[model samples]
Target: MVASGDVGVAFAMVCGAGAASSLGASCVFAVKVASPRVLAIALGFAAGVMIYVVFAEILSQNAIDSFQDAGYSGNAAYRLATACFFGGMLATAALEALAPAEVVAVLQSDPHTRDLLRMSIVTGLAIALHNVPEGLATFVGALEDSEVGASIAVAIAIHNIPEGICVAMPIYYATGSKWKAFFWGSLTGLAEPLGGLLGYLVLSKEEPLSFGIVFSLVAGMMVFVSFKELLPSAFRFDAIDRVVSTSVIVGMAVMAASLLLFTL
Candidate 1:
């Protein structure tokens, strides 16, 4: 499973496997209906994974590396990391504003047999930008601390699950083919590990700088995904205002707690 070129395939398999697991689990027992409470919990879990990656992996690592600097305190490095993380979040927010409205329009206008071919291309570009640094994070973690790396990898995999579902749901709803929808959804996520591999091959020649750049980009990518995809999707779930607010708050709180506990 950890072999080379398996990065994207691994992500797809992991996410698809989760979907498969759910189906299999349903067979053994009664299907666990995802009520508003359950949806909120799943969102919270995703948030926890995100927050852990941003602080624990990004900030803590930066603080340690900066220890050797003459005037720089670990505290300063930590602060800097926080600033960058938030800054990355802001950058993502900005990009979300630029998300092609045409895509959304098309998705809603005619879900079945909708002309999403162009929108899919745009999605691929956006995902590619997001995947590059994620891949590096996975690779670097695996190399430096296999145990920690494995944890991060698994967390990332968990994070990608909803993402896979998000991609597939629309297409599936439109086209009515679970397999095709799943295929595209899973394929889009492969960019991360693929980017990871490419980043490693290119950046490994220069260690610290490579790590820093990779970390920074990962931060950027997360912010983009959060604002551009996750938050929007959360709101799109039309049920009740209370449900939406509760879900969003839970997501934020979950991320905050995960950062404080795992990273701080």
Candidate 2:
């Protein structure tokens, strides 16, 4: 059974995750326009942070912790972690394959007002689906260790900001209504909390949750997202190659420094 304190922490962390998307959406009203180059760079940065976290932190931690918990060491734990990681990749790949094709089409289409509303709705749904695993990852991290949870939350929030912009900008351009755009963007974020709730319900029932598998799975999903979604989107603008590359490097540095600070 989950303690009351753990429940509260999960709730708070999910709320924070939801708010990050809203905060990004609010930029629609605050700034008249955002440059594509800037957005692409930001997307690259988010991808970099996620990739580094998955390899340097999440997978390594899972291997170590799982071995300790299982009273095993060396190759056995490493193999288990590796298997779980690929399993996660496979699961996310399946989800991606099953995702609504309309959402992908809408995101790729030129920004026409006639289709913008439909696009916003479809995009929101797609984002909601993506956020579910992210929410679960954040909750699991926090449940295992508060500091780790906080770090994951921050990384996911940073990732969500670009998503918020993607959702809000087209809506605002199409309707000239800031509130509508923000509403849809925030609506997408609400899925995070719902996902957290689902995770809590499922995990609370387990006598001893298999955190190693969970962590590996989450890491794989994140890496898949970074590669399949973020990096491709970032590279869509060919002119900003230098900017995106620099941003990615900076993002990795920042996340690495944050991990170091946490350790210290």
Candidate 3:
């Protein structure tokens, strides 16, 4: 007999395959060179995607649902979700603090040099692991509501642009080839659909416990990305850093206020 979650899994796989194909094709198109300042701006764009998802989608969704189910007062769920958001942030901060500095440093470097190829491969592995939950989120969203899924698709696509940039930047800097940079950067995006497939397979059933756990895990994963990946990269440039930081706060505040408005 087919497992309960098989359909979801199948959906995820299909989505993953499609996303991978699309990203692969997109990467082949090379763009002209830009300075470090431009690259930093690209990183900031990535920052916008990450921050927007966390506050606008992830935390906002969690707070509303958890607030009602937990039987918290109007203010309590808002407080709880806000706390959870920060908790997610703190958890990622801890992971960043504990993670091997050398590894991230290598990833932050240019991708072209032959010496760093092995390191780049390792970075790919790390990113692949990271991409799984994002895939799942997109898959589940798509499955649940087409509109929700569409929103998520846009968010994911935007989030991915910087990811491509991230992957390409190092390699392009090292090799100075737009083709090579775009190719590698675009390849990283394939992981999203793969992640979506995995998530759908695992979380298709309507078990509260499973839902809660997946939600928590998703929250954790986003936190890790936001702090470990996005924020640090944002800090690499002074102007971008300020803009990204302001964006983060604005993102969080907007979500928080929205939740407050809804609860009342």
Candidate 4:
């Protein structure tokens, strides 16, 4: 059973994830400007980081952990992991389908203020949904290993920067209120802590959680967010192909190196 202290640590780490989003939002106010091309490249980079982590670390680790901890044969462990991964993807797909649509009509609205307000709210809600699994991942990692959790948090924080910009820029432009932008942007990340709390409560029973299943599910969620949300949104910015590609490559390389460094 996870000790009370460990639970506290896990919650703290999850809170840090929320703070990362706030930090990212703060950057928008600091710069007082937003560039679609820059945001696009950042989003591409975030996608690459998440994709690499999901495939290289999370999925592989899930299989290995299952084989070792659950006494499943290698094939069986892999199969189970794959199933859990797909299950997570299906869940995220459902969430995406149900994401708020009322604000979408604002895209075509003639009034710039109305358009920006609606767009900001929509972006915040979307990011909030994406952050749920991420929060769970961070909390779970921390519960298992503090170092691993910290690394994951750093990677997730990097990705959240662009998300913060997405929320902040439009709102600031629309309302010309830094406080409003910051509040909304920070609000988007609050879901992380809530997710973390829920995960802890569900997984902290006397029966230990299944690492394989949970990890695989988390990997799937990250993959869905990377491809379905981050990459597509990045491309929508009309960023130059080379910039996006280069950013993605650089992001993968950096995450790979970080993981390697942490292991050593």
204-251: candidate 2 lDDT, tens digit per residue: 754332666777787788788788877776787435496778877888
* Candidate 4 per-residue C-alpha lDDT over 121-166 given as tens digits, one digit per residue, 9 for 90 to 100: 8878877886888788778777766766765666566667666766
What are the RMSD figures for all models against the true structure? Answer: 6.6, 3.0, 6.3, 3.3
Deviation in angstroms for 87 in model 4?
0.6
Q: Against the unseen true structure, what C-alpha lDDT does each candidate score? A: 0.50, 0.74, 0.54, 0.73
> Model 2, residue 232: displacement in angstroms?
2.0
**Candidate 3 segments exceeding 4 Å error:** 1-31, 34-114, 144-152, 169-183, 239-242, 249-264
Deviation from truth (RMSD, Å), model 2: 3.0
**Per-residue accuracy of model 1 over 1-264 as CA lDDT, tens digit each:** 135544444344333323432231122122332343444445444444554555555546642463323244667655655565566566555654555554333435445454665565465345445544455555555544444455445545544554454455555555656676657666666566565566557554555544554455556555455445544544454344446455545555654564456545
- TM-score to native of every candidate shown: 0.59, 0.83, 0.60, 0.82
lDDT assessment of candidate 2: 0.74
Q: Give the poorly placed runs of model 1, Cα more than 4 Å off.
A: 1-39, 63-109, 113-121, 173-178, 223-264
Worst 10 residues of 3 by lDDT: 17-26
Stretches off by above 4 angstroms in model 2 are 1-7, 27-31, 71-73, 100-114, 173-176, 205-209, 237-240, 262-264
